[model samples]
Target: MNGDKAPVRVWCDGCYDMVHFGHANSLRQAKAMGDYLVVGVHNDEEITKHKGPPVFTEEERYKMVRGIKWVDEVIEGAPYVTTLETLDKYDCQFCVHGDDITTTADGVDTYHIVKSAGRYKECQRTQGVSTTDLVGRMLLLTRGHQQRGDSEYKVERSRTESMSEDSAAKSPWTGVSQFLPTTQKIIQFSEGKEPKPGDKIVYVAGAFDLFHVGHLDFLEKARAQGDYLIVGLHTDPVVNQYKGANYPIMNLHERVLSVLACRYVSEVVIGAPYSVSKDMMDHFKVDLVVHGATPVATDVDGEDGDPYEEPKRRNKFMLLDSGNTMTTELLVQRIISNRLSFVERNQKKEAKEANLWKAMNADQEK
Candidate 1:
């Protein structure tokens, strides 16, 4: 409560497994609607019983949710169902969620309790992206989805055409529509802050797809080394050329938002060059260039040249072991190992959402 009126505290809860720009967008909207945003994350056991095995663990999900820039607070181990008691406890004026539906294993709406009490609000879901969609891409090893070229138009075109006639079969939960990104969306997610003078600016570059706890840990350590941390996200094609096998589950713009959402990131170089050059270093005034424990890859031309040669020659390069061994490859493998479960989860989710839409349409027609 600031200056006579009680501050609006909004409540948002979910499994938040493999938290992406979609989740961040929802939380961003939630924060915009209120003074404070309190996010509740359900535990792994609850999520497994209700949906299926999550790509990330409970602790990972908790940390990821907390990393979202808009989140004011995080409540770990939240119940699968949203209840008035929970809202009362958090002093949240109302609960907010994406327009999509969330249900338990028995196919009951998790938010029915809050909806009936008129304490639930819905924001439009970010289309064309979801954990299910990412898992599907990983399992299928689809490489045609990477947005090529620099312009936003090309990016949107690539993503839209990436979806085929059978996209429904690919990921029922997320559908085929590509996530339309605009300059405004990027501006919205940006911190809009400049590095103070004498601030040691640290620059790190990577694919950073499906941003997980490992990336978070590395960024945290990098930020600890300097006052400002800038993450250089390589273009989709560069990543695919190096990673191969349908790398970068999320496209460039998607990766931009994901990295910008992190509290540790002060700025992001969208579609940054694969090689860290001297011009780039001088331009950003980067004081230190950091890389995770994972060894840097050679140039994309199949040459023996190192990508970090400039940083190393300048003595600006520093290798930091975040102590977390998690990698994007490991994450993809997790989904692959549980391929059947994820497929079933997507099917059931799509069915439930389809039914809900049908029921809503019927009531409206009446």
Candidate 2:
């Protein structure tokens, strides 16, 4: 608990549905308030009663929360209605929440009881993001553009259809999502080890955003070229420079896990530099630096620039042909095309859950 600064245990509770960077950032803030951060996730029924069904199930939400690097502990099936009792049970000094207006089904402020008890703390809401905003991005992607009759969406959609058979449905997070990753698993995946003598270290960098089969195939081919593979993921802004217009649908953290889950990937460099520097090559003992058929980095003025400048200087640069043209743009278009399928899937899930909820309530009454 950070050298026992009174061992503050801070608690935060929420549905955390469709967990994303917004959720991650809030947990970060909550953890900053105390030594130990404990997250409480409400059950599906409680959420359904108050906030409607979450895109991901309660179990899914629980697992996602547990995976965030900031989370210390997670309270599964926490009560939707917070109480001093719950906070005391966890030894949590205060309950933390974003500065958003959250209300119950009856439009009552949910944190009233806690606020009245003088244990409520509010964290700044992450601007430009929310589960609702993300959901809208998927559902109403072609909204304003549709009204304006923009041709780019249609063009991208058609281009995506021609590329591959893989479909994007629901949130892309659910597509490549994995069970909670362990420290050992992460270390092993990241290859955070001293390289053995004669080990051929290959370095590659990109957004690796949606993490589709193309990424798998590309990594497989890259892995075949070296004993260790280090993938450098550019930051979101840098990715946007090349990807353009609502690209990198996943944030940097999400993209990290997505790439880490790849069997062929040895290690991932979070917020890796766009230009491969000599220092990086020396540190990792990278023998080969590879770039795929995607766009290379550009200078601030927008002219094309060498992404592998240091690698090139050291004669360690090479271009790889993974022969897979699939990209995140294509994946997004696939989702756009299969939009109705996902909507129907959600509808079915809601109906099934509603029936199950009714059955449980009836049994309780009996």
Instruction: Go through the candidates in order and give the clash count of each.
Output: 0, 0
Query: In model 2, what is the error at residue 96, expressed in angstroms?
Result: 0.9
lDDT on C-alpha atoms for all candidate structures:
0.85, 0.68
Q: Which ten residues in a row have the lowest lDDT in candidate 1?
A: 163-172
Across 44-124, the per-residue lDDT of candidate 1 in tens digits comes to 999989887888889999999988889999999999999999999999989999987887888789999999999999987
Off by over 4 Å in 1: 148-173, 301-303
- Model 1 clashing residue pairs (backbone): none
TM-score, prediction 1: 0.91
lDDT of 2 at 348: 37
Estimate the TM-score of every prediction. Answer: 0.91, 0.52
TM-score of 2: 0.52
Tens-digit lDDT track for model 2 on 1-366? 667467999999998875655576677778888889999999989887876656656875776677565788999999887899999999999999987656577656678889999999998765534554344446544332211233654553443323323332212211112223345434533435656789899989989865555566678788889888889988877776777776566667667765764556677888897777778988888999988878675672254677577788888888888887766676566556766654444433333434445555699999
Compared with the true structure, the alpha-carbon lDDT of candidate 2 equals 0.68
